[model samples]
Target: MKDKINELLERVENFRPKAVAEIEDFRVRILGRKGELTALMEEFKSVAPELKREFGQKLNELKRRAQERVAALRAEAEQAAGEASSQIADMSRPGSEEELGSRHPISLVRNQIVEVFARLGYTVADGPEIEDDWHVFSALNFPPEHPARDMQDTFFIGKNPDVLLRTHTSSIQVRTMERQQPPIRVICPGRVFRNEAISYRAHCIFHQIEGLYIDEGVSFADMKQSILYFAKEIFGEETTIRMRPSYFPFTEPSAEVDVSCNLCGGKGCNVCKGTGWLEIMGCGMVDPNVLEACGIDSKRYSGFAFGMGVERIAMLKYGVRDLRLYFENDVRFLRQFESAL
Candidate 1:
């Protein structure tokens, strides 16, 4: 026609396209539909009626310069692919190692027994894993036919049998001796419920910490040198402790405490099954009817209470012979305590 519309408007002003699939194959070779401008609009309907207005204005200026040269070669191929993806994107490196999370080996032995009794001043107290029956067993002296106030070992909570759940965090030391008083050096920790029977050494939900130290001349040799400086700050400095004469309707001449095994340094093994000793807690001296049922004048504030089992001191500090691997949240047994945090 007009020399094929000036050779497709000089091939659409030199259509240059390095990428975006060559600007969609140059917009399907100029607006496709059997394109070449739809075969020049069927050769301008058999051109001839007085050259149909100059080949209909040069075929609408060759279809508007083939749609503005395929929209300027698709914006210069998307700005050279966003500057080659921002020069291979190295936004100051350091990124993919992300997997951290560790704690719960019964909260790392209950925060290492509340940081070894918070460096001996104790503090931290808390209560209510749903209790009653006088802060869990008649202010700790427990006897109302005590088989741990049975319903096959307490969980009671519904038909009002004096509510239940707490089978011991000594009901947060009888709710911190019925609302603090007595220079009570606290420590209680938490989570305790027992209807029992889930084993690898028992559990129906567990955890307990308990400690109390009422003021004014507290003893049993100051609870045996504060549990032998808390068993040499948790089993080390060549630990040693002994106590034995046990019983516990809230401690009184009660005792149990063992420690001295740390796996064979006591010269025995099979994890202390060979009698190097390991028991680990339950102390004595607070029961004058559990300090007169929390009003504390049990012959004037004589104190000492102890307790353990933060998953039995995190299975004797991580030798962990399955207390159901601290409640089976097993990410390969919690990624082996991720380097013990």
Candidate 2:
């Protein structure tokens, strides 16, 4: 029994494990239930009484040395593994190529549109998405009976009908007019909400960029030239614009602005519905009532306001038919525009 205890002590002290698994196996062989150490303990029970103390002391020493040896081997193995891993990391080497993020298509288009207007001497303006009825409807000259004022057409907040999500960025223009006087050349770019079904061509939540230019004798012709210049710059140098008579609450003489189809070069295409022109925006001379409502002298200050959906402009530029793609955040859809910036 003393010879067996001496053999185990020698084995435990000399064993050098190359891995953590080896250490676990060694521990199980020495200290686990039904192991060599357990067998030795059982054998000790049958020993003569006089020899018991000597054998028992040797067995306890053997167990203690085995446990300490295992702990030391484990520590050494872990340290060696950590050193090898640190060597492999190689901080001097260049890092792997990272997947770079990109600007959203909506943000890209909005930035482009804003930059175009910025070149035309128009500064950006902002207002709250949630607004009062006076700034959204009354200040904009929308009549009390207008369909837009109804709950079906607009998103009213809580139980109060007056507080609602703006139906258009035109509210920003109205707010701008109330604060700033004539010679106010600014563009409003922001999200607007409506209560409508989602479709390829339209959305309940969309972005609008509305421009307002108010100064003495700001003519419809001035609006025409500026829009023509913008159409050429954004669509192409060869692009042309035409206006059809239209109506709006805030504008006295409203017209729908259309640009010649750059896709078909005015020869006509399916995108234009067999017509050479594609509607892009609405523009008109600001109404006298609207001017007066905003504290601007109606007779002295005249202006033109134009509003277009940013998504609509992006659709035309990118040949994207589905409006839902803009909001979906699908990687397949977004990856295409990574190089656009």
Each model's Cα RMSD = 16.6, 8.3
Estimate, for each residue in 7-66, the C-alpha lDDT of model 1 and write its tens digit: 888888887765578778777877798878888888799999999998898888788878
Stretches > 4 Å off in candidate 2: 1-95
Model 1 C-alpha RMSD to native: 16.6
In order, the Cα lDDT scores of the candidates are 0.84, 0.93
Lowest lDDT 10-mer window, candidate 2?
Answer: 11-20
lDDT of 1: 0.84
TM-score of 2: 0.73
TM-score of each: 0.38, 0.73
* TM-score between model 1 and native: 0.38
